[model samples]
Target: MKIMSVFGTRPEAIKMCPLIKELQSHTEITSVVCITGQHREMLKEVLETFTIKPDYDLNIMKKEQDLFDITLNILDKIKAILIKEKPDLVLVHGDTSTTFSTALACFYLNIPIGHIEAGLRTYNMTSPFPEEFNRQAVGLVANYHFAPTEQAKKTLLAEGKDPKSIFVTGNTAIDALKTTINPNYTHPILEWAGSSRIIMITAHRRENIGQPMEHMFHAIKRIVEEHPDIKCIYPIHMNPKVKTLATTILGENDRIKLIPPMNVIDFHNLLNKSYLILTDSGGIQEEAPSLGKPVLVMRDTTERPEGIEAGTLKLTGTTEEEIYKQFKLLLTDKVAYNQMSHATNPYGDGFASKKIIEALLQNKKD
Candidate 1:
């Protein structure tokens, strides 16, 4: 089987690289990797961590690029590659412009698409901006839906996706964790944090950019100020607005360290060592639970409701008061913290990549 796996962005690369490695192990499968370069430097970090050299790089990233730029550029560039490779199946991960645009190109060429981490939904399109729209649009045309959980499979069924087409493969994010996390890993930041409790932060959602983002930062700032023993390390996103806002609110605090994004290995190890996490990001909701870290999701709504139900994540919406309340509760209440930390991760074991490849092989035989 000639299978082309298409993805861009750091999160997608983290999840997809494990599956790509799985694809390469099978003699019958020709694994082709194509990166859109939607996230450039951050994406490069992950690819290097996994030692994945792409067969094709779209290199479509630019200064101040918007959804229109990403969508149009990917649509224009990936079509020719699809025409040339003409793989038996094209796989896309999650809901970036890369996934949507690449799937559309495959649709145009009559190439079957297998969507990894599929069937996730917030239904509130405006909250996650283009991501909610992107995933739903991909669902409409995907030949196979590799759902991360039974909840995701249920969502796909409710949306009228074919029953036989969906498989409840555990999240590949967990699969990536198995490879990257090192118990003996040490970094300068870890030394700086010393005996202080580490609160790892990642907030770069498009919808949270302006005032909502400020609310999240302010809440974290309050927590850091109140707690002398805890230190915050926010690996700031590449977005300039996020950089400026974060610097303004969180930069000067001695307890808060606003640093550039770390590679996946460092980031995962940091998450492993952290006392807890705070974010408006999607992948972290799944990733943190596996590491036994309690996550405070600073968002109005989340598509990953499984994490909330499993008690590993708390949806503390984007507001200064609400975020402050939740953040304080987690710190002060040991019972609450232990309950969240010990909660069973509903995402998956560490073999989602193998399951995904098995599904493809079975489909090929059938």
Candidate 2:
């Protein structure tokens, strides 16, 4: 079986690389990797961490690229590769423009598509910007739906996806944690944090860019000011607007350190050492729970409702007042903090990649 895996961003690479490694181990499968280079530097870090070198790199990223540029460029470039390789199956991960475009190209060529981390839905098109739309659109045409949870499977069933086509493989994000997290890892940033309680922050969602971002920063500023022992380490995103806004509001504080993005290995270890987390990123919601870190999701809604139900995540919407309340509650109330930290991680065990590959092999046999 010729199975080609396609991914673009850092988050997608983190989840997909483990599955790619598993694919390479099987003599029956010819695994091909194609990267869109949508996230450029950040994506490279993850690929390096997993020791994966793509067979084809689209290199479509450009300065200030919009949704139109990403979607159109991927369609234009990947079509030729699909025709040349003509794999038996093309696999795509999550809801980036790369996933949607690759799936569409496979659809045009009549090649079967297997969607990883499938059936996630917020049903709100504008909240996560293009992501919600991208995932739903991919679901419409995917030949196999590898949902990470029972809730995701139910969502697919309700949406009329065929029962036989869906498989409840645990999330590959959990699979990634197995390889990345190191107990002996040390960094200069951890030294700087010292005995202070660490609060790791990652806020770069498109919908939270302007006023909502400012509000988030202000809340963090207030928290750092009130608690002298708490230190915040924000590994800022590559977006210039996010950097400028974050610098303007949360900068100049002694307790808050705004730094560049870290590699997945370092980031996972940091999460392991952190007191708590604050973010709008979806992958982190699943990843943090495994490290026993309580996460406050800075969004109005989330597709990963399993985390919330499992008591590991709190959906504190984008507002200064509400965010401040939740942040304070998590910090000051040890009972609340212990309750969240001790909650079971609902993502998966480390065998998700194995299960995903088995599903593909079984389908081929049938």
Candidate 3:
């Protein structure tokens, strides 16, 4: 069977790379990769790291492209590739404009689509902006839903997706960790963290852009000031707005190291070595728990509640006081930290690629 996997952006590339490799391992299957290049330059590093080259590159990225541009560009260009490849099935991952657009184009062509990392829902469409809507839109048309957890499956079931079609395959993000977080991995960031309790911070979400971002930054700043033994490594995202805000608020702190964006390998390795995590991003919510790192989610509402219930994560939201209090308590209280860090990862055991492949092959036979 020939299976085409379509994705854009670094997160999608990282998560999908494991599954792509899994598909390649089978003698009976041919894995075809198509990149929309929604995140052209940043995505190349991940693809190179994983050693997965594309049979098709849409080159859809434009300078300062909007959501509408990405969606329409992908929809227009991918149609030709889908027709030419004529894959047995198409797989799209997570809640990106590329994911939704690829799924929608497949729907228009009446091709079967398997949604990787399906069934995540924030419910409030505007909070995550279009991502919440993107996943929901893909859910509407996806022939197979590879839900990462039971909660994700429940979301699909509640939305009336076919029972047989929805499989709790665990998160592919964990699968990516197998290749990414290596024992020999080294970085300059690790040098600064040293023997101190390293807190890896990543906070840049559309919802948390202005005041919310400031609140999170201030809270981290407070924690660093109060805790002399702790050090932080914040790999700031590429958004100029986020960069400016981070520099202004977190600038002069010796303990708080504000660095540029890290590739998946570096980021995952950092997560593995870190004592704890604080983030507003969706992917880290799933990935950090598997590393036994306690996460203080900086968002008000999360699509992944499995971590919270399992004691691996805490929702501190974007409020300055709330964020500060949680950070302080976790740092000072040994029992609280241990409980969160030692919780069994509900996300996956890093076998998600195997499950996703089996589902695709099973459907192919049917």
Report, for all candidates in order, the number of backbone clashes. Answer: 0, 0, 0
TM-score of 2: 0.99
Clashing pairs in 3: none
lDDT per model, in order? 0.94, 0.95, 0.91
- Ranked by lDDT from best down, the candidates are 2, 1, 3
Q: Which ten residues in a row have the lowest lDDT in candidate 3?
A: 356-365
In model 2, state the lDDT of residue 55: 100
> Cα lDDT of model 1 overall?
0.94
Residues 1-366 of candidate 3 have per-residue lDDT tens digits of: 889999999889999999999999999998899999998878999999999999999999987788889988998999989898898789999999999999999999999999999998989998787789999999999999999999999989999999999988999899888888888888887887788989999987887899999999999998899888989999888778899999999999999999988888888988899889999888998888888899999999888889889999899989999999999999989999999999999998899999988877777679
lDDT of 1 by residue, 1-366 (tens): 899999989999999999999999999999999999999999998999899999999999999999899999999999888889989999999998899999888888899999999989999989788999999999999999999999999999999999999999999999999899999999999899999999999999888999999999998998888999999999999899999999999889988989999999999999999999999899999999999999999999999999999999999999999999999999999999999999999999999999999998998889
- In order of appearance, the predictions have TM-scores of 0.99, 0.99, 0.97
Off by over 4 Å in 2: none
RMSD in order of candidates = 0.7, 0.6, 1.2
TM-score between candidate 3 and the true structure: 0.97
